[model samples]
Target: MIASVGLVRYAKCVLFGASTPRPEPDSGKVDFSAAAAAEVSVPADFRCPISLELMKDPVVVASGQTYDRESISHWIASGHATCPKTGQALAHQNLVPNKALKNLISLWCREENIPFDVTESEPNAVTANKAATEAARMTASFLVETLAASKETDAANRIVHELRQLATSGSDVRSFIGGAGGIPLLVPLLSSSEPNLQLNAVTALLNLSVLEANKKRIMHADGAIDGIVCVLSSGATWRARENAAAAVVSLSGVHSYRRRLGRDRRIVAELVNLVNVGPISTRKYSLDALASLAGDRENIRRLVESGVIKVALEAVEDADSADEAVAVLAALAKRGGAPELGVQEGVVRKLVRVLKNGSDSGRANAASALVYLCRKAGGGNLVAELAVVPGVEWVIWEMMASGTERGRRKAAALGRICRRWAVAAEADRLAARYSDVSLTVASSTRMAVAQ
Candidate 1:
């Protein structure tokens, strides 16, 4: 069986022109010809062992074998700690990005017209299939070359712009970029002490992660999430904050990573601060990240203690973010033990306000938050408070009469619980349920978020 398997493997390799040259044990000289193919031909050394494709990004393991960055990242995230090629136990999980090899492969790619771009302008407006097809055309080779440098600030800025464009371009582009070793190469930039470089790298990763495969690779890459959280917990420009938060949102969405992510108080605090005062983009991502983090019940208290509830209440006033904010608030409430925190934070009134005048989606989510807050053990009494809000009954009735199917169900359910159950009242109900509570905690959190 073993001999037959070897024969089949050899046949496959012969057919594909894909095989790694093995070095003899105890021999100091490893054959260099196969891996050292000239720019005119693809180098076998550039191909990842797992994917059997030329590696755009290569990383070495403890066993001294190299594989594509995405392949290895996914393997690590799935709980393996062994070299794919040698099956040797990994000494550690840290991945050292292979910049030199990437540089060589990138140079070769440029020469082959495989295309890479670091653009100042957004080329993102194109569709994924279109961009993928067009990838054979000249890529912004200048940007590609710029990325290979360690200290080219101007080039790095353009790298961010072009990466963002490609991220938005579509799946094919992201798949191509990921397969080309883009994620592995770019992830190191997130850890740079230079704030600009970190910002550019994170923003690019945030965009690149829209591609499904890139998400796994970005999450497990050494220092990627930690660096992003550092920027979030510390201070950066609003754009940087927005980009960082956006990246966190993407990473936190993966369930396996959320447990570790939720334990970070800095992450929750900064996201709460961003929810309170960051720009719309930042707020949106923070809200989503919070929602995902809340999935871990252990993180709920820290989130509430960090002022997440109050900031989320205030966020309802933003037309663009109200839906997401309310959804996050609902998730927090449902997480157990944190239901009362929302009531104390004035979530009831903010939700009522959303139900009264927020867009359809916002109304539904707000209604959901209100229902959870009023029905939970710690918050059941708050149902009466919400019942008396001037327009509460009217909003519920309005939803049942004209809102979306899901929204109407939430409104109807809330009406029944509060005994303000009538779908008939038209009085104004959206009002502040309580003044901001424990501003001391929130104040301290804001300091961490910005200072």
Candidate 2:
């Protein structure tokens, strides 16, 4: 084992020659021929006992077991190679180049007349080298095509099974089909002439969109957004619309994609309108996408100017739909950073009122949003107003008082806010009362804090 480790170290040192930095991401073709052409004479000990060869196929000499050369080479390359007999790895330096290849090499040497001298000769063998290189290249090309076909076939199977699952299962079966390529394969199917396949494709893409990476690719794919919107405008089934809206919601999660949907008339005019007009379920996800994208500053101004904010605000007012108010408030807080916009006129006050009267989750979201808004607004006045609002102080006080498990969690968050506020307010009062002394104290305190 120690000898093997030493051999590996020596081999790496010789091969890598001082550990140079890796090249940047490949832009041009990778010259595997160049790499294969670089090999020198095979190491002596790495020769296979069975063939007494240079280990042409890299057969594994494992615990009374032998692997084909290709299998052994692949395992070694992946750092998975082990001796079949002892389960110990071969020394990294002990590369078993094809020695029986000597006959081939000698013929090539005579034909090509490249010397055996390392300083003067080309490294590749003469006879079998060209055949080996061609075989490897052809095999790699074939493997790539095979994998692509397999992915398309698997996607078709997923589409069929997914439809049956969608109809019979209680929840969306997206989590079951996981892969970076799933979205790409299913996108083309969304526009398939076959209705069942088209429906299943939409369902699959919707599920794929739940993942951030998949959604990025789906949106970037040619005509994907337009195809989905066309489906929406064509009066597809509610299930289809719901899934489409979910995909839009996923796309909207990326801020840069806001404008991608703008030019698609089916999206802006048809789907955006559905936030207020579609069936209850469809409207929910559609509004969610609209609300999230509305938080993008330019998109927010565009949406508001287009009169969509009013519709969203109205939804917040409906008694049966008050649950959505939290989402509306959160979105507005994100888009409308300052209380001056509309936070002062109504949003904050309404959220504050809800803090006293709404359900626990709603009240929690409202309270969190108010605190966030106040912090962003950055004023002593806003802080004072929040501190003294009817039930606001008591709510915080009760939160700090409860001492239950959840209450303890809330207490930690509130404590940090209160601590910062206390320090900032005290610094202001001291600066006014004892200007010079306050400067000295603040400096000393700052130094101490830094320490």
Candidate 3:
């Protein structure tokens, strides 16, 4: 029995290693398998159509399609004009956050034992360092308090300028400023007579308006639109007016705000006036605001009545402003302004030049505007005119052969109209020639009879 026991002990020692416990897996480290992750069934709605992956930040485009913010932004930046999934042309490129969807996605991730940091997914949230973000928040709070207590004009300007810088730093800092009640304080200074104070205050509001929440806050604040319009209409300096226009653009991102702004005819008139006479930069900013507001029918009417067509026609002739000008024209055409555009002299010719040699976006807009104009003017006259323009038909043919999907559609429509007009004209000439030949033959027969 003792020999058997010794033999058993020796066999266990050789096979299993002597007196060593099997090391438990390190509790701190968990190994996750890629295959296992692949096997996880993510909901379809949780995935971005462009990336085909779970969305970290969901944003809804004007087409009402929800996509990952980065993915949709890249799509728009790459010159795509339509929604990826629905293929509808985007009315505007505003990417409103889908907070409810984001919350659902976060909840799903937690339930599935996946790691997702919601705060890290903010569109402009500064997440590189928690300590730095906290410091910025604290600093913003202090500045807001100081600005509230400040009675000296020089000191107020300096403080407002600092707050503007902070607001421009990141979305988090803007949120902090808004949270600290900085918007109300800034609104009162928008109409300040002091140039620097007015500039700084309007600029600070402009910077803070970048965040969606701050946009609402700024819009709803008492006399905010009035103040911004005041600055835009009669600010002491061009830079202040430019930023005031920019702020209007930012606020008009929301549809309701656009309606409210449309109610104020002065806003539209001021922007039109700027586009007519302001410097290059100010005109550009004014054009941007006008473009955003042009989405509403009332705003389009306001723009037309304010003489936008004349300035837009002039802008189309200038290379610096042609693209934005064409885009605005297209928007107006889509929204009941086509008749006015059709009445403008040389508008068709200018658009033809753009179609031949403008940037991709400009070409697309020009094509769209021309099509709308032709349709509104009764295709025959405009189509005949277009068919005769030097190289216009060739440009249309090329666009049909090779262009973006939307561009191709517009080009094909224009080409069809032109071709139909050409064919009809050729048929009429042939028929007239045949009639003249028959009449001459009859005259010869009559002469022979007389002889």
Best by lDDT: 3
Query: lDDT at 46 for candidate 2?
Result: 30
Q: Whose TM-score is greatest here?
A: 3
User: Can you give the lDDT of residue 219 in candidate 2?
Assistant: 81
Clashes of each: 11, 8, 0
User: How would you encode candidate 1's per-residue C-alpha lDDT over 1-451 as one tens digit per residue?
Assistant: 4334334433443344222222112211111112233223345456554433456557766544566666577667767666543233577877776777778877877777665332221322333234334541123232344456536655565565455444443445566566665676676666566565566566667766654577777876777767777777663456567667666655654556666777788788788877876766567767867876776677777777887777776777777788767767766776773455544645577778888888665786677777777667454457756777887787788888987555777788887886643332323232222224456668889999998
Candidate 3, 1-451: lDDT as tens digits: 4334334433443344223222222121111112123336566457664434467789888655678886588568757686654335687898888898899988988888777768745443343456566667666777788888889887787778667656655566778999999999999999999887887788788878756778889988998988988998898888788778877876776667877887788898899889988877577667767767776777778888888888888888888788768878887887889988887778889999989988655787788888888888665777777788988988998988876556777888888777778889999999999999999999999999999
137 in model 3: Cα distance from truth in Å?
A: 2.0
Checking candidate 3 for backbone clashes, the offending pairs are none
Q: Rate the local accuracy (lDDT) of all candidates.
A: 0.61, 0.48, 0.74
In model 3, the runs with Cα more than 4 Å from the true position are 1-88, 91-125, 427-451
Candidate 1 minimal-lDDT segment of 10 residues: 24-33
Candidates in order, TM-scores: namely: 0.59, 0.44, 0.71
How do the residues 58-120 of candidate 2 rate in per-residue lDDT, one tens digit apiece?
322322233335334433553544432122334442443344444454444445543432122
Model 3 vs. true fold: TM: 0.71
Superposed Cα deviation of residue 447, candidate 1 (Å): 72
Off by over 4 Å in 2: 1-199, 232-234, 253-272, 294-298, 319-321, 337-349, 357-361, 371-392, 396-451
Candidate 1 C-alpha error for residue 131, in Å:
11
